[model samples]
Target: MHRAPVVLERAADREAVPDDVWVELRRAARELGFSQIGVADVDLASAEPGLLAWLQQGLHGSMLYMERHGLRRARPAELVPGTVRVITARMDYLPRATSDGWQAIAFERLHRPTEATVSLYARGRDYHKVMRARLQKLADGLAERIGPFGHRVFTDSAPVLEVELASRSGLGWRGKHTLALSREAGSMFFLGEIYVDLALPLTPASEAHCGSCRACIDVCPTQAIVSERRLDARRCISYLTIEHDGPIPEEFRAPIGNRIYGCDDCQLVCPWNKYAQRASLPDFDARDAFDAPSLLQLWAWNEDEFLRRTEGSAIRRIGFERWRRNLAVALGNAWRETGDAALSRALSEAREAASALVREHVDWALAQRDTPALEPGS
Candidate 1:
């Protein structure tokens, strides 16, 4: 899907700066902590079909906003008035200060099976703050470079189709795992955008490098990667544990493993992750709460403790009820694996949680421990 870079001069003219301004913008974004920056024209018609297809297939699950927005997500100008271009930016987030042995630490938690396993991304402070701040700084620098113009900035915001803009702008190609990826940086990063009124010279799209590699597909613990580049989000552990609100489906409970929060099996196992780079900023440090929590440890958290522990975290958005519900599923899986008296006691302890939702999940979990043979059917 790579396209030739449009030619333009960088003379700082009122009409539009040349393509060399792209180099300057890229340098400025990097200096502001972004890993890469690319500009894409507002026309995203190519992605409209895929957006419609994914929605029609109900792959978005309970994220009703994705369906509610309809084609506005793929059409930048419709979402934001006067947006002729999108300045897509990327920033790495592997935690620059993490010890070299961290990947091994993550894998070790999975071996225990009884301990909670959270997605690597959620262990840190909420990325929304860090990325949005730095992206504003990058935008400020752009304003200084080419003078003030009408623009709006976004990071992980619901109003935009960020991956589509990133891929079309040469930031990276969308991988088979459905993440924006680069051969140099893999998918361990955040993306932000500047919907600008001024028409900047657009960068060409990057080529897809996934080729015949199906690492993400093969690594899904719950077989959520239903096809090469398509995901059955309902079966995804991250979706079930984080985005899903109702009862954990009967068919996906055991396969969810110990992922009490978000899941990272697919991304962790991607061969391209060998090239994964660390974030220059340390905003993504692993919080101690998620390091090696046991089902018993997490199940003990009251609503007050959950609120205090997850404050300023993306995990908080799921709210305490879904949080407990997800943990209940994980605890059930843990109990099925090793019928521990403590887990049974804990499940019994939570049978009267303030929220009936938590109590219901806990009741379901206790029943799972009572019938281990029935648990494996998930």
Candidate 2:
């Protein structure tokens, strides 16, 4: 069920926030594993036109919720009445165990077609659970400092323009890939917000640092980054494998490669990500099975096994059918590349029990065994 918008009545008797509140909030946020915090005023009228144009261009694909929410996303005050300032928090999500040269390691996984590559972000506990709970704690700490104030916490859960809010408040500049990028933290962090009635001072916005660098746009598997900052989600492998619910589009299947959950190619190629910070909390550590599992290993999972392994994971939200569908596509890419009879046999075995959607992809996977394997980026 969709959650009703959280609207809190502003407290008439609320105490004036202390001038040192921002300093206190940052100290508290850091203790809770947040990398940085900033405040953004609620006026986002200037962003509406570009947002409307993106929606009108159908770049968001089947994410109809983006269309439905409309300008309310830009106007945070309308979504949460009396929301004067949005407290934006950034948390670096590179797993605690991630090592130096991790981007190279991730690129290596992409080259090994038989390996099932889950995006680093989805490898551990669901970020929604981790981020929301911490953001609520941050809000609670503020309430303790300045008495009770109307506030609501959010991660990626709502229609809020998270990147816009983060960028507006100095968390980072929007990178060419359209993700918030900081010189200190790169594009590998999660962003959360606390909408409050308190009138806090706003953080100054950061200036764009990506000059003449087209790495992110140039590296997209399907060229989803249509221009510098514009992404066509329809062609994006991450969207195709996750947000997109139907059959894998034919054109993007080969380029999708072995990425079964989400794609990290754009981030991997970005020059700034060498500075990507490791997650301070253990909540994002890569689970053993997902660390570098093979296509066959993930393919063997029955619905019950899929549920068991993906418990408390964002991957579970995609459900078992989509899970198998993605695996089938990845297995197909592997089958083409390796001409591995094991991949073909695995797809054939699952064909009978699969849903019509999965079976179609399974059949496609089996058919790929005879195709010539093209080199990556060919």
Candidate 3:
């Protein structure tokens, strides 16, 4: 699937790439469902210190791969030799059927302890599949025009600093939550990159718009955002539910609430999200099952059913063990909050049949029936 790298025969060959190529690429990107596209130079040495600090602090938790990749993440040429300019793309992911006041609806779900609250981005097909295919297509279209360039496409698949490249290329600015934020598209979009040897015109970086806003930080159920742009990923709910593979930390269980997949508290509270755009492609539309699934409803699924239901979803990546583990914690929280006999019954019935990890969580959930349910965010 790899193409031979492009080689310049002479010094003049470097200038053969048309300067107006970006204008045509942007038009092709829009046709392929990307919301915006930009070009970034590959000098990311300025970002290496911050990336090193984050990793050295053990903020990445169990993701040892981050430590393994090291500075190669900051150097595109090292990862893919000959990378000079990177093409960055943004694609909005809000479900096309999303209504007005969607943030309120998200907040409402958090208050309802028995309802399963998945992050908005994961309610549809796996974005890795959706984005990777489109990105490859975008690269193919460019090859058609520019006639075979040395390039490689990436979404969240690699160690490249997505937000840094994104912001540098005028896609958006880094918001308080450390997510790339655009005035026009907000933070509810996915980012992808194509590292190419072509010396394309660089896109100007956008200015920071979050003046004094602390909504994203204050609204975090786990306070994962330690400072304006610094995040402790270990404490992030999205990381807890999706990345951390072992048992859910006891401290974050209750605050984790009914979020079985990822959390969107920060994005939900951001004022800029009021302008969040919906998906141009139907691939991001929410399935009927994930829309308003209840705790017991999801709890009823065995491994086989779990696989069948989550076949093409990002949720499937967690596998049934972690999936059940997350569900058990949410169920425990639900048992304490409502003391619903059915919730208790569901947990008890699954206890003996569950995996060791899931069984432990199930036992913890059953114990919640005795503890007083604290108020949300208390």
Candidate 4:
């Protein structure tokens, strides 16, 4: 039934919006392409101790920003002066053409020690840009209604407890893998936040549905998901390849499979991912080299090719050095698995990479050339 027209008009011309305003806000969010809209009151004090403990354990790896912010991250009002409530948003990002049971496709890739694999999330345009712009647009639309109210929008930036807000706002439960998960959306979506001074109605939080599932923990290559919802980033392939600056630890090397940029095993093994949704925007479609480039083909790209191809993509942030370093590791694993002549020659040339970091990784890759040759079967 069509009810009254709920509208927020004129700046500072507003007091507190009625609870039913959430219905209108949610409708607007759906029109703007968000999968879910949730409101959360600014009470995250419980998350503070875990945040500090995660930092103190140095489990954040080299992301110093995680350590830089104090507990203001847990306290929204402190981060943004008048943030009485937070509007949490979720956008589904699975690639559009992913076929039925794509999780099996991803899981099979992890078994091929020769194929270079990247996390599904980074295969397209940088999510940081895609999510932040839409979030700001949503915030702007709200400001237009309520008038010049204090607000801040963030998407994976510093000082925002994104997962905490997501879990609290009825969007989803925190999965055992540490990502926010929903029975409907699984865990394959991007999260964003808009902090506003007004006290909007909050959504009823979702209950934990993980139950006894431990698929995410058992499949971790580096055992990074050491325990449920407790990641040890030091051994995480994503942290080692993208965030860490030094040598790839020797111990974690063989277990890494061929994931060059990020790891997706845990998500692939999760049964709930059958509910994963596809992205509506073309901005997230896979492009250029990310669309299943072979290890040798990708290893041949020079620094200029790397820079130009990865422009505006999240992979570019790792720079050409780490790019080569990661590819070299993958090529090395390929060599160990197949001992292909082409793989060996590529590793030889890579040994002289312009950057010292790249050269070191290349040399390590070449050392795998003499891996024990497969024996004849009985």
What are the TM-scores, per candidate, against the unseen true structure? 0.91, 0.97, 0.97, 0.92
Query: Which window of 10 residues has the lowest lDDT sum in candidate 2?
Result: 1-10
- How does residue 213 of candidate 1 score in lDDT? 87
Q: What does the lDDT come to for candidate 2?
A: 0.89
Residue pairs with colliding backbones in model 4 are 11-147
lDDT of each: 0.78, 0.89, 0.89, 0.79
TM-score of 1: 0.91
Candidate 3 global lDDT: 0.89
Flag regions of model 1 displaced more than 4 Å.
Answer: 1-14, 18-21, 99-104, 370-378
lDDT of 2 at 109: 85
Residue-by-residue lDDT tens digits, candidate 4, 1-378? 111112212224447777666676778788777999898988898888888888899888877877778688998877766567899999998888778978877777765656678788898999888888888777767767656566677888758888889989999999999998999989999999887767687788889999998988987877798788999899888899899878898777666657889887778888888899998777778785886778877788888998889888999998888888888888777777777888878778667545887787778777876764321110
Estimate candidate 4's alpha-carbon lDDT, on a 0 to 1 scale. Answer: 0.79
Question: TM-score for model 2?
Answer: 0.97
